[model samples]
Target: MIYQIYPRSFQDSGDDGVGDLRGITARLPYVASLGVGAVWLSPIFTSPMRDFGYDVADYCDIDPLFGTLDDFDALVAEAHRLGLKVMLDYVPNHTSSDHAWFRESLTGKESGKRDWYVWRDPAQDGGVPNNWKSFFGGPAWTLDEASGQYYLHQFLPSQPDLNWRNPAVRAAMFDVLRFWMRRGVDGFRVDVIWLLAEDEDFRDEPVNPDWKPGDVEHASLDHIHTQDQPETHEYIREMRRVLDEFDDRMMVGEIYLPVVKLLPYAGTAEEPMVHLPFNFHLILQGWTAELVRGFADSYDAECRLRHSWPNWVLGNHDQHRFKSRLGADQYRVAQTLLLTLRGTPTVYYGDEIGMTDVDVPADRLVDPAALQQPDSPEAGRDPERTPMQWDATANAGFAPGGATPWLPLADDYPAVNVAAQDGDPASDLNYFRALTRLRAEYPALVGGAYRSLETPGADVFAYERMPEHGGGERVVVLLNFGGEAADVAGLAGGDTLLSSLGDRPERGAALRPHEARILRG
Candidate 1:
C-alpha cells in the first residue's frame, strides 16, 4: 500500500500554486485509482526552499519548484504506466546550505570539500560543540563566520549535517540512489534514516530523565549523541547495498525508533536493511483500543522476533490529522487500523478522504518548525502540510483561481473533497475505495499472520489475518475504539467483509459505535 505524496501539496501543474512533476503526472490517474502499490514522492530534489524540500540543493537536478528533468521523466513515465510505483523523498540526512556540496564545504579550512560538512572547533566555552539541540530550535551548532568553524545543523540552519563518515558522502548518496533507480524509482522513503550516523566521539547527549516543563527543545536531550549510531547500522547496510542494485528496488527507512530500535532497520536477515523500518508506532501512540492492542501485540511480537517485515503508518507529512487526531468518529477507526495491519501500509495524502488539520493562521505560517517554535505544541507543520483536497473549486482544487496556496484550504474543503468523496458511497472517499478493494481481494490481507484476537473488553481491538503458509480465508479485524457499544462475541463463523459504518453483521457480531468490522473466517 504505500501512498505518501506531499510534493508541494500534491497537484498543481503550472497553474502554479506549487505542486509539480506535471502535477504528479496529472495525478497519475488519481494515483492509479487508489489501490496503491507505491507512490511516496515528498521532495522533488534541487531545493533551497529551506526546509520545504527538506533542504536538498540538487542531488541530480529537478526542482524548478518541482518540474523539469523532463518533468521527472514524465513522472516516471506516468508512474510506470499506471500500475504505479514511484517513491522518492530520499533526503539522506541533510545537504543544501545551498549545496554545491554545501557550497564546496563553505570554501575555507583548505577546502577539499572541507571534510564535506559537520565541521567543529568552537567548544572550550566559546559555545556549541555539543549540547546539541536544533531539531528546529536553538543550537545544533552553526557559527561558521568566515570558516572559524561550527556547522552541524540537525534540522535547519539551512540544513548542513552530512558527512556520513564521508566516503565521499557515501559515494554521493549511493549516486542519489542510482539516479532514482535509473529513473524508474520503485522505492525509497529514507529522509532522516536515523540521521545517517552521528556521535563519532562528539558526545554530550544524556539529559532527558523524562524532560517535562512543556517539552520540545529536541525533547531536552537524551538523543544519545544525535540518534541511533553504531555507524547507523553500517549506513543502513550501505543503503541496503544500494537498493540491492536495482531490480524491484525497496528502501523505506524514516525511522523514529522503538520497536526495539525499529527492528535493526530490518537488517541481519543475512544483512538486509530498510525494506521497511518505518513503523512509527501508529504515529507515536495513544489512540486507545487498549493502546492499539498493546501496540499491535508488541509490534507483531517484535516483527516475528526479527525476521522483520512489518510496517504501518497512519498519517504523515509529520503529525496531527489522524482525522485531526482521532475525531470525525475515529476516521473509520483509523482507516480500519491502517488497512488491517500486519505489515506494509503508509497511506497519507489527504488520508483516504477524511483530511483535517488546516488551521495555520498568524498570517499563513509557513513552517520552519512553525517559524522556529511559534509557541511549540510540537512546532507547527503548517497544519499538516495543507493542499491536495482536489475538488470544491478555488484553491481547494489546490491551485490556479489566482494561485496562492502554499498552504491553506481546509475549511472542510467543501464537504471534504476528492470530488465530494467520489460521489459518496458512504464517503471517506468511498470508504477508501472499499478499503483498497478490501486490500486487493484479500490473500488474508496480502500476506497475513498477525494474531491478537480475544477482545471482549478494553474497547475492542481484535485481530486475526492468518494465511502466511496455510489455506486462505481467515480475516477477523473488529476495531471499535470506544464510543461505547462493542460486543464482538468472538465469532468463529465468517462473512461480514468490511464495515466501519457500512455494516452487514450477523453470526455473533455487535460493534456499532465507533465500528470497524472485516471478518472472513
Candidate 2:
C-alpha cells in the first residue's frame, strides 16, 4: 500500500503548529508499522506558501518551515531503515513568483531570463492576451509592470507557469529530478502532468456552455489545445530515464483526465512514461456498483491491451475524504475495493483513522484558491489540509504544547483519533492494518490480474483477483454500497479469508449494508 503523507499536516514536533521533516522522521515507524510499502510526501521545498507548497521557490533545498536539508536527509534515512520507500511530490510545471528564475524573468524586458516563463504581449484591443482562466478563478495571465508583459499562471498568480518549450528550462527541471534521485529518494508523484504545455499561438479558448461556478474554473472551456499536449509524453520519457538510473524507483503522475484519455500517459509497456498515471475514476465518478464496475472493466481492459500497469486511488488531499464522501459504513466497502483492486493503491493520510474534512472558516483559510473566492463554495482545500489527529489531547496531539493547529482539527477527532482506535480490532485503523497485511501476504491481491464477478444486487460490487498461475490463490472481494443487505450468491464455496464485518454468516448468505468481504478459493 502507498500511503500519502501531507508533511505540513502529519505531525508538528516543534509545537510550531506546522508539521516538518523531523516530525515525519519521528513518525516513520508508525507508518512502517501500519504495513505501507511507501509514503508519498507532498512538496516540502522552499515556497512562499501562497498555494501552500505547490508554488516552489527552490527545488534543491527544504523550506525552513519544514526543517532543513539535514532534517530531510534524516527522514530519508530513517524511512529507508524502516523499509518504507519515499516518493516526493515533483512540481515541475510552475514555480513560486519568488523563485530565482521567475524573479530574474520579472526583472525587466532586457533581462537575460525574460523568456524563462510564458510571457505574452497585450492584444491589439488592449485586452488580456487570451481567454484562458486560472484554476483559482479570473484570467490566467497577470501583468507585471516591471517586465511590461503578462505572465501565464494556470493556477495562482504567485505560481507562474514555466516555459517548458525553452531548452534551458527543461534541462533545469531535469536537473531538479536528478537532485532528488541523488538524495536516495525512491520516486516522485509528478503533479499536474497534464498542464505541462499549451498552444504555441496565443488563441482564445471557446466558451464552455456547460460552465458552472462551483465546478473547476479552469474546465470552463475544452482544454483541447491548452493541456494534455503531445509534448508532455516526451518530457515524461526524459523523467523516466532519470528514474531508470535507480532500480525499483517509480514515477506516478497526477493525470485528472477520464480513463480513455489516461492511457497515453502510461505509454506502451515497451516505452513507459510514468510507472502509473494515477487512476482517479473512483474519486471522480459516482460510487454506485454499476459505475464502479464499468470504470474498473474499462480501465482493466485498457491496461491489458496496452500492457501498462494499473493504479487506484479513492481519496487524496484535493477531494473530500472517502469517509465524508461515502459515510462510515460505505467507507469500509470502499476501502475493501481499494485494497483488493489490481494495481498499487494509494491511501491518504488519516484515512485509516476515518478522518473527515473539517469546515474551515474564511478567516482561517490558507489555500490561495479558497482565499481568492472565500465566500463561494470554493472554500479551497483548507478542509482536507487540516492536521492529522493522533489522540484526543488538545490539538489532537499533533503538536507538543497543544497550540492552535495550522488548520482546524476535526470535530469528531476525540472519538476518531488514532490513539482511540489503535488497539480496537473493530476500528477502521485496525481494519486498514489487517487489509495491508493481507495484501502483503498474498501476491494475488497486490500484483494480480483483476476480473469482475457478476452479483445479483446492483448495490453489490464483486470482483476476483487471480495470480499468474491458476494454481495461485484466487480472492473474491464483495462490497455492498447501498443501505439494504446484499446476497452474494456467486461465491458460495470460497472460505472467508478477510472481511470488514468480522465473521461470515454462512455460505450463500446475505451481507449487511456497506459490508465488505474477501473470500479465498
Candidate 3:
C-alpha cells in the first residue's frame, strides 16, 4: 500500500497550526506500523502558498513553514529507517511567481531569464494572445506591465507556466530532480504531467458547441493544442534518465486523461517513461457494478498490454474524501477494491481512519480559488486540508497546545479520532491494518493477474486475483456498493479469507450493505 501524506494536514509539531516535516517525522512510526510500503508526500517545497505548495517557489529548498532542508533530510532518514519509501511531489509544469526564474523573467525582456517562462505579445484586440482559459476560471494569460507581454498560467495567475521548450529550463528542472534524488528521496509524484507543453504557434482553440452551463469552463474548449503535446514524452524521457541514476527510484505521473490517452504516457514495457501513470477512472466513475467492472477491466488490460505498472487512488486532498462521496458504510467496500486491485494502491492520509471533509465557511477559507469566487461551489480545498485527528484531546491532539488550526477542524473528530478507535478491533483503522497485512502476506493480492468475476448482483463487484507461480493462489474479492444485502453466489467451497465488516464463513453468504469479502480459492 502507498500512503499519501498531505504535509499541511498530517500533524503540527510546533503548535504553529500548520503541519511540518518535523511533525511528519514524529508520526513515522505510526505510518510505518500500518504496513504501507511507501509514503507519497504532497509538495512541501518553498512556495508563496497561492495554490498551497503546488506553486513551487524554490524546488531545491524546503519551505520555512514546513521546516528546513535539514528537517527534510531527517524525515527521509527516519522514513527509510522505518522501511517506508519516501516520494516527493514534483511540480514541473509551473512555478510560483516568486520563484527566481519567474522573478528574473518578469524584470524585463532584456533579462537573460526572459525565455524561461512562456510569454506572448498582446493580440491586435489587446486581449490575451490566445483563447486559453485557466483551470481556475479566468484567462490563462496574465499581463505583465513591466514587460508589455502576457505570461501564461494554466492554473492560477500566481503560478506562471514554465517554458519546457527552452533547453536551459529543462536542464534546470532536471538539476532540481537530481538534487532531491541525491538527498535520498525514493521517487516523485509528478503533478500535472500532461500540461508540460503548449501549442508553439499560440493558436486559439476552437470553442465546443456542445458546451453547456455547469461544466468546467475550461472544458468548454476542445483543448486541441493547449496541453498534452507530443513533446511531453521527450521531457519525460529526460526525467527518467535522471531517476535512472538512483536504484529503485520510481516515477508516478498525474495524467488526467482517458485510459487510451494515458497508455502512451507510461511508454513501452522495455523503456517506460513513467513507472506508473495513475488510474483515476474509479474516482471519476459513479459507484456501480457495471461501471466499476468496465473501468477496472479496461485499465488492467491497458496496463498489461503495455507492460507498464498500474497505480490506483480513491481519495486525495483535491477531491472529497471517499467516505463522504461513497457514504460511511461504503468506505469499506471501496477500501477492499483499492487493496485487492492489481496495481499499487494509494491511500490518502486520514482515509484509513475514515476522515470526512469538514465544512469551511467563506470567510474562514484559506484557498485562493474559494476567495476568488465565493459564490461558486468550489469552496476550494479548505475542507479536505483540515488537520488530522490523532486523538480526542484538545485540537484533536494535532498540536500540543489548543491552538486554532490552519484549516477548520473536523467536528466529529472527538468520536472518530485514531486514539478512540485504535483499541477497537472493528474500527476502520484496525480494518485498514488488516487489509494492509493481507496485501503483504499474499503475493496474489499485490502482484497478481486480475480478472473480473461475473457475480449475480447489480451492487456486487467481484474480481479474482491469481498468483503467477508456486501454487498460484487465487483470491476473490467482492464489494457491495448499494445499501442492501447482496447474495454472492458461485463461491461456496472457497475459504473466506478476509472481510471488511467481520469474519464470515463461506456459503451462500449475504453481504451487508457496503460490505466487502475476500475469499481464498
Instruction: Return whichever of 1 and 2 wins on TM-score.
Output: 2
| RMSD in Å for all candidates | 20.3, 1.4, 1.4
> What would the TM-scores of all predictions be?
0.36, 0.97, 0.97
Residues 46-154 of candidate 1: C-alpha lDDT, one tens digit per residue:
7878778888888788778877888788878878888888888888888888888788878888988888788999889887787889888888888888977798988
Instruction: Give lDDT tens digits, candidate 2, residues 354-418.
Output: 89988887688777777776545754777887898899888888986766779888888889888
Model 2 TM-score, all chains together: 0.97
Q: Which candidate has the highest lDDT of all? A: 3
What C-alpha lDDT, on a 0 to 100 scale, does residue 404 get in candidate 1?
88
Cand. 3 TM to true fold: 0.97
The lDDT, on a scale of 0 to 1, for candidate 1 is 0.82
Candidate numbers sorted by lDDT from highest down: 3, 2, 1
lDDT of 3 at 511: 70
Per-candidate clash tally: 0, 0, 0
Query: Which is the winner by lDDT between candidate 2 and candidate 3?
Result: 3
